[model samples]
Target: MSTASPHLQGSQSVATGPKSHPRLEIRNIHRYFDGRAVVDDVSLQIQAGQVTCLLGPSGCGKSTTLRMIAGVEMQDSGEIYVDGKLICDTMFRVPPERREIGLMFQDFALFPHLSVADNVAFGLKGSKDEKRLRVEELLQKVSLTRFIDDYPHQLSGGEQQRVALARALAPRPRIMLMDEPFSGLDNRLRDGIRDETLTLLKEEDTAVLLVTHEPEEAMRMADEIALMRGGKIVQQGAPYNVYTRPSDKASVAFFSDINVLKSQVNGALADTPFGQFLAPGIADRTDVDIVFRPQHVRIDFDRAGKGPLPTATDGVPARAVVKRARYLGHESLVEFQMDYDGSVLKVTVPRVFLPEVGRVMWLTVPRNRCFVFPA
Candidate 1:
């Protein structure tokens, strides 16, 4: 497969839409196989020069949605529009090549027989000079101009990946579809390459829809995140909004480790070892889970075997014995056994603060940080 290429000067422009139309839009797209809905009513929009990440776990229909948008796989039902112009639907369709969409996948897929310049120029159509100029411009943009004459086998993995990126951008695609494009690189190389790729894509002013299962990748690269699950988009928002204000317990758990305290709601409140948590609107006697991340749990030294005083935000402090603690480079993860209940709760403390096992510690969960979800 060919990687997407950057736009050439004077190449045909994509169809324009009214000022209100997004750069790319999918309306209630659905795809199914073997009587199962692989992609269910997934819809999203991407503005020019923005990056939207389709984030989810494996088998969650992320790739299926990308394929449908690329026009590689037809959706069972829905419409795909570019610049408010209908490009695809059940009855009307546009060829993948004509849609001016660029594609880059996990594998670089550079042609073994071609040089870096040729590979980048593979998707270009014009005079010889025009193609060469386009390839050179893209190579320079990716910082691979020095290796233009080298073959794929001669370059390092990172270099090869840059070549793929250059080739993808060479065609000057209006929209770029990347499916785990950075997963193939080593951890050390992935971050740098990802940053570079983001810069180039943004400079080109191309709307991008990147599909990845890694939350870290989505958080780092996306301007907007579409959280997918069971073939549906569970949430869509800015990374900070989505991470800090998740819609459900599962959404909270997806981004990081969470400590859940289960309790029955009574009088719009759920009582726990920490304190009473407001669960307004939940019926009385309904089971609810109070969720908070490990990082949000504040640790305090025991005051003569007594916990700290309760506050409106921090709530009442609870005593727990440290069960285990491990230093994880940047932070230390400490597991605690609650004195009231034998349940284990994990807490992440910044830097190195490894308390010995059986050490008593006071724990408090900020009331504002806790999420009350029905069990």
Candidate 2:
């Protein structure tokens, strides 16, 4: 949120501190397979002590971009730089093992035959005492010092993950690449481990690029999120900015359930059941979509078959018949059929508020909460 120098180009957005080199930077990275581009012109910058999530659905090139940055998979084009020094490009390359980059995947990948301390010390260099000291320090940081002599088979899934993290950090890598590293843990353990891992990574001041398809995970872990789709980043910014001010309808839908109202633009305005929405630059007769999340729809009791009067902020209320209602843990979701067009719309209310099917209610949407996009 506190960006020093912000730059925007097409769909890509990057913010960097002034007069400081980013710990990891990739420019126009492309990767192809079977004559199809798996990664296309992907670019991002991660500063030290920052976590940037490359977030998207499956097969959206998030993993490929991470692999390219880790130096395990070469990009077809583009350049990789660390501290303003070029590490990889079309003509030069840095081997994965020599790149000083740490990698953690869904699988712990620790050797069952080796002790925990030995596994962590595998990447360290120095005398026996120094290596042991480094391993002990990392184990303590991960809160596994007591299990230093235990093998991977002796540890639980979460313990094994902590060991893997310790092993990756023992070498003091400047950059850490994580590919759905918490996917293996159960929901109960996943949250705790994620927080712990984040704290450890930040303490080490490592630039982390995490690849995740889960929007919740990205929002929870990322200092900045680069939303990827079809091998390209469509939006990149702080989690709040990316969510509150999306680039398009698809971007909005990616974060949560969305309800769309379709209308034709006339005189820079689109008429909906609630009221007219301002479509500033849209041409007359052009089709447009008014998109808003379910939570933004306000519900009120209907009196004598009439709804609330129109207001400047919230437009006129419209009558809707309840089609169904389900109580989700944190909120109640109610689906409704509009009296105006019979179109279905969903609204979410906090806590348990379940109305019987066929019950009538009035709904109003705040004009400012809606997004008008060309259809």
The local lDDT score (0 to 100) that residue 205 gets in candidate 2 is: 92
lDDT of 2 by residue, 160-210 (tens): 999999999999999999999999999999999999999999999999999
lDDT of 1 by residue, 206-287 (tens): 9999999999999999988999999999988888877876778888899999999989989988899988888777889988
TM-scores of the candidates in the order shown: 0.94, 0.95
Residue 319, model 1, lDDT: 94
Which portions of model 1 miss their true places by more than 4 Å? 1-19
Clashing pairs in 2: none
Q: What does the lDDT come to for candidate 1?
A: 0.89
